[model samples]
Target: MTWTDATLEDLVLLQRGFDITKAEQRDGQIPVISSSGVQSYHNVAKVKGPGVIVGRKGSVGTVYYCETDYWPHDTTLWSKDLKGNDAKFVAYFLRTLNLDRFDTGNSNPTLNRNHIHGQPIKKPDLPTQQRIASILSAYDDLIENNRRRITLLEQAARLLYREWFVHLRFPGHETAKIVDGLPEGWTHCSFAQMAQYLNGFAFKPRHLGENGLPIVKIPELKAGILEKTPRYEGSEVPDKYLLNDGDLIFSWSGTLAVDFWNSGAAYLNQHLFKVTPSVGFSAAFLLVAIRECMPVFMGKAVGATMKHIRRSALDEVMHLLPQGHILADFNHRASELYDQVQLLRAQNQKLTRARDLLLPRLMDGRIPV
Candidate 1:
């Protein structure tokens, strides 16, 4: 059977998302889908699910799929009408279009509905749509399951860190001595002392290419190295800037985050800190500690346009450190958890690459449903 040659309008109707200010938002479970996926949550949902969303403002053509009812924010374009197409299939099909090419802005890339709605797209019939979606969704289903497991594992690690470090509830707290609001054999350590923060060297546009070491920017940090991520084919960037797998990455500016790198070695771009624990510090400890410092870092971030925490913030935020014996004991427990997380993350990356490779082949009819 031949697939129909049609415009995007024939498959689905894309409309500008509704507007909702941050002040108007309240705590809830309904995801507020923006151009960058789910950034916030709302008490009420604006659209029914499952929905397909394409970035129209900031992220520029990035695609997102939501399973539950959600509010599509002003920065995105959501499918108002599926037009009898499988929603999941439409989501995967849009990914193969390379919609970012439709960007019409010079400085800030933007996606306009009018520009793409009349564009040509080859789509199959309803039955084929469902079959393709089913095959692809099987991959998604496994990815999502692993994602939940990762979340639970991370939560367990965080709780363990907090319980032993913050709340002072530890294995033998009953017998521990306390003095001047400090436990015996405990001393405060600043964030700066805990790890070495090596900011990545700034690389220019011409440095990027289709091959070589993948560059690690804030976007790549948030969403690993995606299909569209820029690569550096140039000469040796300084050794300090090359980050290996399982290294700690701290993005001090623009959506502050602390996470361990799961992808293989990549070039570290500016606005990212490649953190290495000090001689006495452990990677697992700093990973959790830095995450806990996010609120304080956010409070000190200074910028009207783009908020960012300075290096001074690291020195300002301090935490109590136990003696070597206690620290080593904690590291032993945390390392096991961190190792499990790394294993799962590495597995997810392989699964993602496999699915992404299969998607274009399946969508292009190279692999029939």
Candidate 2:
């Protein structure tokens, strides 16, 4: 195996992506690669498969490796030419470059191709690059497998929830009587009746720090973990604003979503509600109930700029309360599945940390392949 020293521009051609508006985006399987990974799916692909993308604007230096054909959004710079370099190897190499340091903008960080083009880079021969990528991809493949398993487990649990609650086909349902389109003892009640929504605190920008309590925002809620959220260093942070693992959080403002806070201790930011289920209502039940209400909440959301769900909307949302024994049974069964999901998520976090630590070292030849 051999290596050669060269500039980035010599190894690949970087071209700005095309502008695709949200209105024009049709739903399909082709990923829409933005500055921060796949943002959405589009029917048409702007770039071919086995491509590498670099964040040129908002999320500067972020790199993505797409195995399938994708539509790279205008906010990114996609590789128009690899110049015979291994695509996956290029992705890894870019990560080792610390492209963030090449930001050309002061206020809003941005990456300019011309600036990065001149930077020196070390490249290994095709076979050696393949070997390095294979080692790293093995970890990625395992992570992906775990993710699929987690999704399946979650789906199975959700299916059981629907079968028992939505379809009214629980154990011994043959003798159960129905009234008002519900099981004999089941009652339709407002969300407020079953759960208490502790709205997050408003933390000012000045109070934020590099090291402190992670802020759980809407994005964090969507991702089921905190990523790139700001942190706050305040001993005065009220107990109500602090979060715990397994806590059910609902993003009531922008992009309404219900998720478990599997990530460790964090501060709950405004527009999010840390929901605590009342007696007889299990966290599992609350999660499903809130998820069922998402469509209705989204429909009622109002905003000229960014749509948001109001507290009033959540207050009006209804849940079908099951009998005590039935709710307990469901919680007992689903809790195991939820625990597995959390375990898998935690495992992925660890795998990610290990892979990330190995990435730069392997790419820079600090750790041999």
Candidate 3:
């Protein structure tokens, strides 16, 4: 296959996205795409899909591909003309440009469409483009499938938790008597009593390095997966700050969330807590308990801009503790479900690494399609 050098403007049309405020957005199926990805959903769509979206501001140079009709926000630029080019291939090709370098402003990073339109890029003929896209897309499809499976497994486990604990409908519930809206053997207890929250070490910026331990931050917790985490020098990292797989970590500041640390050995950063279950509780139970208490925690969080939960919040949050036998049974069942999620997540991490390694090689013709 032969490749030709061509400018992006020669192959496609770039147009600014529409503006839609949060107040105007209504709940629906159509995704409202921003520079970072889908910000929300709306009932209406301005652009039809299989379309490619490029970040124009804020998160400059980021690229997103939507397979369904979507609403592109003003912070992005979407393709208006493919000119017989493969849409999937265009998406892959865009990533190779490292578009972030073309930032037009000094302070607020921005991508000027005019600059990117004229930028030179090398691409193969349509058939080869499609072939390359197909190969790379296969990996993404597998990753997406694993994500769906993980969601289903989590849902089933959460439903079981609600049935056995919340609804007081455990296996032998028929024989148990209800008192004060609680199952006969269950007792109310504070979260602090069931688990211990270890705050992360405060590492200065100068302490970070290009190699050694990766630092898990609020962004990692929100994504539910860790990638491109900044590294900290091993010598500077304390023993207590190190993390292990399946450990539950909660972000107390900025977007409160709870997730298991599936990513291999890393250091927990400040504003996060490495939650360790006490003798009577399990990681699975603690995860659900923290998730259920999120609304209350959010309400109590104090801050004008970035809300933060105080240490006192943990003491105030309450949970119903089941008897040892019942709790053990619940843990046994939920642990199996959570273990599967961790396995799937680990598989996705490998798949992502493989895809990233292959993307540039495939795009540059180092790996022929």
Question: Local distance difference test, per candidate?
Answer: 0.89, 0.85, 0.88
Residues 1-369 of candidate 1: C-alpha lDDT, one tens digit per residue: 469899999988999999999899999999999988999999999999999999988788889988899999999999999999999999999988888899998898899999999998788899988999999899899889989998988898899999989898877788889988878888998999988999988998888898998998888888788877888876657778888888999998888998988789899998899998998788998988889878988999999888899999999998888878888888888888889989988888888889999999888788987
Quick one: best lDDT, which candidate?
Answer: 1
Q: Any idea what lDDT model 1 has?
A: 0.89
**Candidate 2 structure quality by residue, lDDT tens digits, 214-234:** 888988877645446788887
lDDT of 3: 0.88
For model 3, what is the alpha-carbon lDDT of residue 259?
87
- Rank by lDDT, highest first: 1, 3, 2
Tens-place lDDT digits, model 3, residues 142-219: 999999999998898888888987887888899888888777878988888988899998989897777787788988
Work out the TM-score per prediction: 0.88, 0.87, 0.95
Q: Model 1, residue 286: displacement in angstroms? A: 0.7
Native RMSD of candidate 3 (Å)? 1.8
The C-alpha stretches of model 3 lying farther than 4 A from their native spots are: 224-228
What stretches of model 1 exceed 4 Å from their correct place?
Answer: 25-29, 105-109, 202-210, 226-230, 233-236, 253-255, 298-316
